[model samples]
Target: MPSVFSALPGAVLDDSGLLHLGSPLVEQRRLAAGEAIAPLGDRAVIAVPGEDRLSWLDSLTSQALTRLDPGVGTELLVLDPQGHVEHAASVVDDGETAWLITDRGDAEGLLAWLRKMRFRLRVDPRAADDEFAVVGGTRSALARVVPATPAGRPLVWIDPWPDVSPGGYGYAAVDPHPGADRDWAEAIVTRDEERRIADAAAAGDLVLAGLTAVDALRVAAWRPRWTTDVDERALPHELDWMRTAVHLDKGCYRGQETVAKVHNLGHPPRRLVALQLDGSDSVLPVHGAAVRVGDESVGTVTSAALHYEEGPIALAIVRRSVAVDAVLTVDTSDGVISAAQEVVVPPDAGRTANIPRMPRLSRRASAQ
Candidate 1:
């Protein structure tokens, strides 16, 4: 179904929904100031309802979910056996069901995996995208626009990024993390409500931001996203995701061993960095654009945007050995552009354990 947001004047939509509305910069300002909301058409919802839902999910993901409280928002990651991220979701339980909000492209795969893993468990996970749409903005902005409460509790997921969640670890060492001021949340609304919100936007009663403005704010906040930042070999450590997603003391899951080993004794092979791109050429590098150190390719740009306050900014995953102070270049369609690196995950991000060293004995002393 075509998004009702496309009905607004100057709105341009892609396969997902509203990409922009002609004035992305202005939209960004309004959105950040709590005067606008963005329709998250690229996000999908999954409803997991059953007697054993929380415990079943607790056994399958990175977060400790067995005791998840009603209306509290958290995130979880499903990993491959090797600890590579396979799926990620924002979770909120309404005392009866756990709602999983994930990327639209990942919804089918995640649902299939959940169904396949339900071995006589009471949980039933089903796609809820047809019934609900996601809307994102500041907490206050959403409060002004009431969200759906089909079960008598507002369906909202508050982001926990840049904070060390209970049983979770943090890798970023910067004081006052860039995401500290990000007051973001997502609300699940009925399809009828989505149309009504769009109508209000069309009538100038409500302000609407687009995905472009949303991405800009996200990049500025140093937020990692599932669709844009994750790759086949991506790990929570590499993306500084330990701050919110991985529970260091959680019970065993598919990738728990690797997650523990990396944090305690080994370093992740890659590290995430924020890039302040040179905007002289006015071209933003696309995803997979090579990040270079001198002439050597060191990484690939994951997400890039023209932020309202920061100009051109991007997030990239680079080899762990890359110098934090390295002046890098990014290959764009227009040309190669210079970028300065701001470390998100340091090269020494792992090996958090304090193992004691054993004394070595000399051969002569051992003979005695």
Candidate 2:
């Protein structure tokens, strides 16, 4: 646990072992209004230094980041050889160092992999967990409380969810997307600054929120996270992650062939969906709860939350063959409850666009 969260009153920890406000409703309201900040206990930071840091990362990840400008917010994914998401991170580079904000559980492994691949490069990858803590809020909200970074920049990674970033693609066919207004940002804060913020919150100068509030909002926005929503069989397309994490035309890297093939000629085996769980019992199903269509098991719930406005909501990954209209049931310890499916990544997800080509005159006609 981060020392800063110790100052919070009536804080309850979640399954991720992170502290959150006991009053979820109040926290949710504060968060929605951009008046709260949450200690991102599940997140950690990785520092990449030396001259070739940016170019080396660009050569390895899913995003095109070779020319990334200082203080720019972008994200990238380390993909498996089969194009499955191995790891994902929110990134921002100060003039001298590139900071990666990743799930805490992934930081050590990601650091080791980067070290293995840096045989002769100028990149030095290291975990900075001891020196930095991650705090999350909306960009506008975070602007009011400045955090200090090792590189002296206000190190913030702005989320670009629910939109088609440059060199990315959008597969969901919807206007006024739910996540269009997700202004989430994670700031790397020094321990002293964290304590100062905590003291302010403790003294009634600032409001504090918990992970429950954050996750609930993320569910409502149909945002996919690396830790909860991913399994061994997960594909980027299933989560509609191509909207930001993938660059379709970037130079070859690991899994590029599989990513290209699936986009152009194949469909992902599974798809992500948002579910409105039956709230009659007021019980939220735990993560990994089984989702079934009648007697047959169809999918598994990745994350479940009680939103301020949406009641009980969840994100589930089900087979692409599952009918969109199916009324599913989630098996919880309390009992089975009905699940109404809302399409996120639809069944026919990987169709390639037919780009029109310009007509070229024949050589014989040109000669004539």
Candidate 3:
């Protein structure tokens, strides 16, 4: 199938001021391969205020939130008691409050879960408005478009230029087209969706992409999306999500014991490895397809795609015991698909190597 992520789509503004970024779902029907298919922006934000924000979040996530700077953003994970991830997202703060942007479908449910676990803490938890928006394109077009939100929360509202981002419920001042009115091209998915954007870009509104384009972009960026690279039962160390999400020394969270245990000494549970699938007829493996070393099932394919840049690629959760040169087969209904495993990290960095005991963290080191 042709990949939609390969090229940007087209749209035009009518004389009446309506801008049309041709609906990918409506016009194209089936999404093109690799298209970023979602309406616009997967970026999510959660706000935490009051005095206990840092400690509260530090206890909830796998990262050391205390060290995270106000302006910078880092990825972190919320793990279930069993050590599986409950939610995954970027953690950003601005001194007063902390913002968490997570996977789309899981945000609300995860927020509800966090609320249930809020035992006697001064910190409040909830999904921040999804109203966050992104403006991508030429700088000349957005020169006049100043960000219109207060500090802490990003400057979301786009001024001077036009073209509202897709999703629900937000208005912006945009040029939608050559001379389109700012209001005419505006879109609203839900009230929350509009609040998710940080600043405005000049690209205007691109069409809503299907799942296809998103997969391609994922491979190109080596961005490990949820479920694809992680399993709830798996430890955070296995997948190396610490860069953005897991705070290396954030105090005790729900699964902090396991995270700390895995980080200091014992090897991680499993490793998330990228794959290059072989053959034209061999389709990308579906989630849960058994990956084999000869006949033994060593892992399962969590996410796969026929990428525009890389013909076929996937993310798989494989046992740490699997050999470095392991050649695995994905057992799909159609047939077996062959792929080579390429390990991104090993136990030393984050992946666990079954050899030593859990290491201890110094109080100073655990501050974050």
- The deviation in Å at residue 66 for candidate 2 is 0.3
Candidate 1 residue 339 C-alpha distance from true site, Å: 0.4
TM-score to native of every candidate shown: 0.95, 0.92, 0.64
Each candidate's lDDT (Cα)? 0.88, 0.82, 0.51
Off by over 4 Å in 1: 352-368
lDDT of 1 by residue, 235-258 (tens): 999998887898888789999999
Q: Encode model 2's per-residue lDDT on 13-75: one tens digit a residue.
A: 654534576788778778778898887888988999989998899889999988899888888
Kindly indicate the candidate among 2 and 3 with the higher TM-score. 2
TM-score of 1: 0.95
Total clashes in model 2, counting residue pairs 3 or more apart in sequence or in different chains: 0
Candidate 1, residue 136: Cα displacement in angstroms equals: 0.5
Q: Tell me the spans in candidate 3 whose CA falls farther than 4 Å from its real position.
A: 1-44, 119-121, 129-211, 347-368
Cα lDDT, model 1, residue 241: 89
Provide the global lDDT of candidate 2 against the true structure. 0.82
* Candidate 2 structure, TM-score to reference: 0.92
Q: Highest TM-score among the candidates is held by which one? A: 1
Residue 83's lDDT in candidate 1: 99
